[model samples]
Target: MKYFTIFASRNDTNDMEAVIREVYTGKHSIEKTGHDYTVTRKSLFNRWRIMLRVLSEDTNLDYFESNIPGMMGFYDHIPFADEHRKKLVLTQISALNTMIAIEAEKELGDEPFRLCKELLSKIGGIGFLQDGTLLDYDGQVIVYPDGSSGPADFHPRACTRKIRGEEIESEEGERRRQASIHELRERGIPYLDTLPQLPPVSECRWKSQEEIARRAVALLIVIQYACDAANGGELDESKAFVMGLLSKYGVEDQLTEDERRLLSEEQPDPQEAVNIAWQYEAYWPLIWALQLTDSLDFPDRICDSSYAIEAVSKWGSFEELYRQTALRSREDILDAADKTYRLHWACVNSRIQGQDAPAGMIESIVMERRRGLFWMVGCGMEDWDHIPMDT
Candidate 1:
């Protein structure tokens, strides 16, 4: 399934409603996994809404790791305005999307309408389980006796009636919640409300979801191919499809002339070449996250790629050179790269402040770079225009 579909079907209330009908009657107007206009547009708008909601809630989503599902933390940032106001904004935006979806239904088909309503239902259905009582759809909890674990404890004829009908009594819910709290406390797990407050984003690096998805697609294809080749398996047919895409983007021809030539002399397989390329691509975020956490587990190849000489010969600037070099995994090379980066950044900062970069500072930085061993630094370029950018 497409990434957006998974998110949409699971989170969008309208989308859920559409599916529930299909589930009940075993009838559908459209097929799943087909790249139809309705599916594609719904997926697009779902992603759009998610991004906007993130921005509206946290305002700093561009900086640091946005607390998006499957991206980072489950909480990105607190809502910017009052919670009610945020909800109002989200509702208004969603309603507008519903209107657009209605128009799409008229032109495209009922499938769009079904998808929109179901997706909307999915979003609306989300709720917090308050206190310690897990409520049913009717908001009533079937309580158990002290020793029983089955619903037999709530047999209409056998159990003592505390409060009948829907909605767990507030007192009962509190009592159950306290019991759960006590148990968790004994195990040393923090309560949800008492957990550490998320700090503001300190660095902005991640771009739009589309950009991330494009990178992800490239990296996933390369890695999947690598795993297949690493196990002495034949090349996957999907490699050809990805290759075609690369060709359309003008990247395939470049790779064939340059990267392919280099790989032929080293890693003989085309799949391996792609894998290596993706390895280079995947390293960027790992390094960035590590830096923010002040934890290092990888080598810094951001300045040690063998392509550096050829790339520089081709008039590649420092940033391009660095991004290319960031692809390899040699320990000595990564150390040197990190040192170079540290020195370069330091020099830039010194110049910015009208201070002379200290004499032999670069040498000291180079020496200190040797201290990192067995580190698996990630690969990628820092935005040069943004000084003091995240790793």
Candidate 2:
């Protein structure tokens, strides 16, 4: 459950170093030798450290979160400023746990996946119900196991019509109910299990899908600006840029011509980029929680994006930004990304689980960001030599 900041070298060399800075914990000594920097800490569960290890070995993964603990439990007991804040945190935890469960099912083998689901269910986090419906701890269904609610009723009339070579089909409503029932039986849920599963998590169907997509796209846009600024106000040929980003989300090949055209034509100013990044404050924490950069495609995006270039180019350097603005603007962007990510999960979880999304969740997230309470850059690069070699 420990938290740390990763400061990577901003140069283009095979010997780039990453400084792992531990925070909110006991002091640790920092040791530097050649290209490797280490902060000796007692904790064994260093997420970034493990991620780097995995990346260096180039292991194949079915899903990014499969091996990573959901980490939502860390926030469950932490006190927030208000009820709204507390709700926001809880909702985010639920959404994250749900996502983890989905990944487990998709990636793990039968025994391991079953155990994972059972463990989550026992912990009251999120997992599939006995009826194969996805749900959070509160018994709100998020995804239907059979992809439908129930089966259709048997109709004597339909049988007669078919026997006479006439087409007779069950009503859509009846078919849906029957399909749901059949799925419930297959998943071993009680035949009478009537727990309502509301808005489905089917792709492109959820009401908040558009909002999440918009925010995600905005994030890439801001990142593009940051990359450009770092590369002397020009796109970097070596860096992945927009196409690289689109690929991470598995949407690169699916982009319509119009979307591609817009991305190519749009030339947003630095201020506009910052403003767009700020607009999605609620999602930032979720992004941080999910450790989006840990995904296989993400490191390349970060490395290629050259966010540090912009940090240095616009603010003179990371050190200057850190000293003068307390890294306020950069921190703000990270915070927004995390919160917006959480808000999205909350909305998705609510829709699937048949629960109302927390009221004013987005507004509360934005307000918290404005208050400047949680300010920390989740990840970034810096000049290796500039980092202090002492705790």
Candidate 3:
């Protein structure tokens, strides 16, 4: 009896059948097409979008999974399937704001080692990846001269969630903090059950600019309390509160001892800070948008056109105006952002296409006037069907 290796057969149509059987039933359902929905990249994309939408409905994971690929981690963590789950996690979650790293020593063996090494190399700072043992979220790592780490070193007050209605609020208020922490522990099992392990800040870039701004906004919490005490009944009105928030986020340069003392000293006025909060709220979306497009150097460098749309629309408070200005055809890339953005793009495109612009004018005019141009510019894109050069 001669037993042959069927896998060595010239016609390998069987591989597709195996993929259909294994991958189809695994995550994505077998659709009317009678195949795994994620077989094609396009199909996988569709499935990913569906999963993202479903995940979005769950408010708790909003802080947990934003910019992080929540479901994709499940596939990578399957022990038999892949061991380089850390690297995969880093790649998927690196670009997004809001990263979390879990410690995996006894249970997560080898995974933590790879995660720590990558984090240390990519992002080096004071508490980013505490001794490559613990994970820090921001670019800053908290390293003491004595070599100790944890909340003690950097002391990040995480956003514990409180259920008020369908939405969740941060655990700033004392009463809310206690209630939220309890609810989080009870309801958070699903959110955390399948994580491979949390890598450090160096492991991945967590905390989008929006999240950072929000944390900085926490400094306002202190400011509000201080102002209430100072005013007695009136408002202790000043730029100190706003300045303190920016200083806390490290957006501003060096501060005087007076400013630092003030921030450390007292609480802010709630009513005054309440009015100020709207500006910070508006700033958050723009900050997030800036971080999103932070990678782009020249307008020509922007390869991902979808992000270009978002950068224009939500970068500022007036979402509708941007939406109208940026209303381009589905396939159109150039006309999707703002017209001022379009002008900057034209300059870049002009450079890339070897067209002549005023000397050094493109460089000066392109990115600088984006904020100003964004406000006044209108998008009256005439030709939507034409795909811009190289796009």
Candidate 4:
């Protein structure tokens, strides 16, 4: 029951039904309303020419998030260019990637091709709603509604024309593209001429640094109280502080599953205690996000619990801690989000391909960092659990 739309040109004069019958190999029905033709293909992405001709329009893709399989030769389509935009020279269609997969990228050497979007939940962290799968025949990603890190393919109902479909799908063009990368690498850089403008911040009000500081403080309070309960420390004093935070910010709901259990019960299972320790991994990212710390280091190991505890402990009150906070600029936060997004893709890909994580990245570190970044960039989303972290 996967439903999506194909955006075809109004100028396309071919009989819509005939076109579908010619290009689509599967048994499906097309309900031609006005300009739109709704077709059900028993399968998706089976042929080269069929794939190209299916898309005579792509402007409708704006309703969905777009990902590039590789660098699109924007210069190849000068008519689609805008001199005022950074995209004019060449804009890299970024898919989820890490350290720029220089070798894997050779498979998708720069060539003029169309882009498409999935009409799925646009809210998931990079791959939360989308699985990274490649087309069996072509090795291009199958863009679904939820999301797709489409490095090199399109659906019959997806794709757009940056140039004639024939040239791009031609044997000569494919051969040229294979050789193009090595020559470009040998002579000059094959990197983005310009970065596309990232999606703007959502209209939802962004949480102030003060609010996040309070959140961090509240979470720590609960964790500390849980520790005392576990270690047979004075519950009375610790409960007072934890209750105070709950009374104000109520970040208790933000705790991990085990941490939430700790709120009710005094004792933590041995397994729970290990998870609670990893809460520092979660806590460290928040402090880093708030600029309370500089960089969040590599994820191969645990973050310093002492430094994490001290971060909130040094400030006498929640208000005092927030007052000292200077959140990073939107650009800085987005950069981190972009970095995590790509690295996360790498981490997921490694597991799928049975290889080591790129750049020694651990799943936990990337997950924690992604959780923090997703929250920060998500504009108005306040609930920690509500934040999506699939990438």
Query: Best-fitting candidate, measured by TM-score?
Result: 4
* lDDT of each residue in 10-72, candidate 3, tens digit only: 111223344333532444443323221222113443332111010111222343322233323
Residue 5 local lDDT, model 2: 14
Winner by lDDT = 4
Per-model TM-score, in order, reads 0.22, 0.20, 0.18, 0.46
Question: Residue 333 in candidate 2 has what lDDT?
Answer: 39
The weakest ten consecutive residues by lDDT in model 3 span 1-10
Show model 2 residue runs off by greater than 4 Å.
Answer: 1-222, 226-232, 236-240, 253-262, 279-282, 288-391
> Against the unseen true structure, what C-alpha lDDT does each candidate score?
0.30, 0.31, 0.30, 0.46
Angstrom error of the Cα, residue 171, model 3: value is: 36
Error of 4 at 254 (Å): 6.9
In the range 1-391, model 2's lDDT, one tens digit per residue, is: 1211111111122222221222212534445554334434345652122111111101222221221112232233344334443343333322221122122212244443333434334334443333434344433443344433222221111111112112212243234334555643454332221111111112112112222333334344444544454344654442346565454444454443433433454453555344333423423322332233221111101122343223223443223333332212332333343333333344333433455544433433333232221222221122111211100
Candidate 1's residue-wise lDDT over 290-316, tens digit each?
231123322222333243123223422
- Please give the lDDT score for candidate 3: 0.30
Residue 239, candidate 4: Cα error in Å is: 6.0
Evaluate model 1: give its TM-score: 0.22
For candidate 4, write residues 1-391 as lDDT tens digits. Answer: 1212222213333444454445433454444554444434343652121122222222323221222312132222333323332131122122221110111111211220111122111111111111222221233333332332345333222123222233224443334333433433454323222222223443224567766676677667676775666576776777677777666644555555545676656555645554454456666767887888898776777787788888777766656777778888765665565455545555654554466766566866776676667676663344664454322
